[model samples]
Target chain A: LAKTTQPISMDSYEGQEVNITCSHNNIATNDYITWYQQFPSQGPRFIIQGYKTKVTNEVASLFIPADRKSSTLSLPRVSLSDTAVYYCLVGDVSNTGKLIFGQGTTLQVKP
Target chain B: DAGVTQSPTHLIKTRGQHVTLRCSPISGHKSVSWYQQVLGQGPQFIFQYYEKEERGRGNFPDRFSARQFPNYSSELNVNALLLGDSALYLCASSLIRVDNSPLHFGNGTRLTVT
Candidate 1:
């Protein structure tokens, strides 16, 4: 399993864009980058996933570089409710059932 | 359709005691995975069961064991628990045992070892 490192916490104001970067220097060729959002006392929710390049959805966007060593999760127009712990995971989900999570980046959306 | 469901939203146990936690996967989901999340930290993988068989095991001790039923429901059992065992036990279900398959998680059962 590839380990990931992310910022412990980030601060942003409402209506501003937020970008959280994750570093996985040991990422494998078969690994995919996935991001999840978790609120207080709840399970983490799937936000976005990408293998390379950029993948965008209604909720968030994932940008992966050619080296696949790092990825960024961009949240647009943040709101107070968007405050949560964001986790970045790298693995080949097609082959394994286990997901290794790091400490995660706590994004605090303030008004 | 209902999502993954776990029993006994909260539990309090004493050291050296045993505890059983149950989880009912979503309809048609064939894979169930268990995780333990300590406060202020991310969740740690414990076990994964697919089609009533053990698919993967984490670094957990033998005291932690799990089994899946034919219906795809699962139970996590812990024996001779210690104070460090206190944490939120999470159960997630997926259509398959693949990582790409999005995991549907329940609110999790909070276990407190006194």
Candidate 2:
């Protein structure tokens, strides 16, 4: 399991693009970086995932450098509903998919 | 398709008592994993079971145990519950073939220990 570090919280205005970066200096070669979002009283929901470079989906985009030591999740056109806790996880899914969640970055989207 | 479902959405127990939480996976998922989420903190992995076998175990104490039935449904048992045991228990299910497929999560069971 690769330990991840992220900002404790971030503030964003509606209609703005918000990018949250995570640092995993000890990422293993087989480890894949994944991001999840969680609202109050609910389980974390999958947002996006990437191994290297950039991967985009309907919801969000993931950017990983060649070193694979760090990654970022980009949310476009934010809204108050987008305000939630975001988690960055680096682990080998082939093993058990047992994710170790850190104190995620709380994104507060304001009007 | 229906997402993962957990029973007893809210539970209250006293110290030194026992409690059980149940989860039903998606229609075709064969893997079920359990996590503990405390207020103001991220979730902690507890156990993972695949094909009725234990696939992974986290750092949780032996007081916490789980099993997956042939149908892929799972049950988590906690004994000697303490106040610290109070937290939201999450159940996630996924197919075991692909390594990168995302796990579908249920709303979660909120257990409060008194």
Candidate 3:
């Protein structure tokens, strides 16, 4: 499993774009980067995933550099409800069942 | 379609006691995984079951065991628990058929050891 490094916490105002970067220096060639959002007392929710380049979805966008050692999760026009802890995980498709989580970046969206 | 469901949203147990947690996956899903989340920390994988067989396990002790039913439902059992065993236990379901399919998690059963 590739270890991930992210910010401890971040504060942002509402309607502003928030970007969280996660670094996995040991990412393998077969590994894919995935992001999940978790609120207090709730299970983590899948946000976005990408192998390389950029992948956009309804909720967030994931940008993976050519090296695949780092990825960024970009949330556009954030709201107060978007405040939560976001986790970045790197694992292979066949072995994702045994994912290892990091400390995660706590995004605090203030009004 | 119902998502993953776990029984007993909260539980209080004493040291040296045993506890059982149950989880029912979404319809047509066949893989279930267990994770333990301590306060202020990320979840740690405990076990994974696929098609009623144990697929993988984490670095937990033998006191923690799990089994999957033929219907794909799963149960996690912990014996001779200690105070440090208190944490939120989460059950997630996913299909191996889908590449990079994200896990669907339950609200989790909070276990408080007294």
User: In order, what fnat does every candidate score?
Assistant: 0.66, 0.70, 0.57
Please list the C-alpha lDDT of all candidates, in the order they appear.
Answer: 0.92, 0.94, 0.92
Model 2 CA deviation exceeding 4 Å by range: none
DockQ of each: 0.65, 0.77, 0.68
| Top-scoring candidate (lDDT) | 2
Candidates' TM-scores? Answer: 0.97, 0.98, 0.98
Candidate 3 per-residue lDDT over residues A55-102, each given as its tens digit: 999988999999988999999999999999999999963554889998
Candidate 1 reference-contact recovery: 0.66
Q: Which window of 10 residues has the lowest lDDT sum in candidate 1 chain B?
A: B95-104
Task: Put down candidate 1 lDDT per residue, B72-103, tens digits, no spaces.
Answer: 99999999999999999999988874547777
Task: State which candidate, 1 or 3, has the greater DockQ.
Answer: 3
The global Cα lDDT (0 to 1) of model 2 is 0.94
Worst-scoring 10-residue span by lDDT in model 3 chain A: A90-99
Pairs in clash, predicted candidate 1: A93-B99
Which of the two, 2 or 3, has more lDDT? 2
Q: How would you encode candidate 2's per-residue C-alpha lDDT over B6-78 as one tens digit per residue?
A: 9999999999999999999999999999999999999999999999999999999999999999889999999
Among the numbered candidates, top DockQ falls to: 2
TM-score of chain A of each: 0.98, 0.98, 0.97
- Give residue B71's error in model 3 in angstroms: 0.6
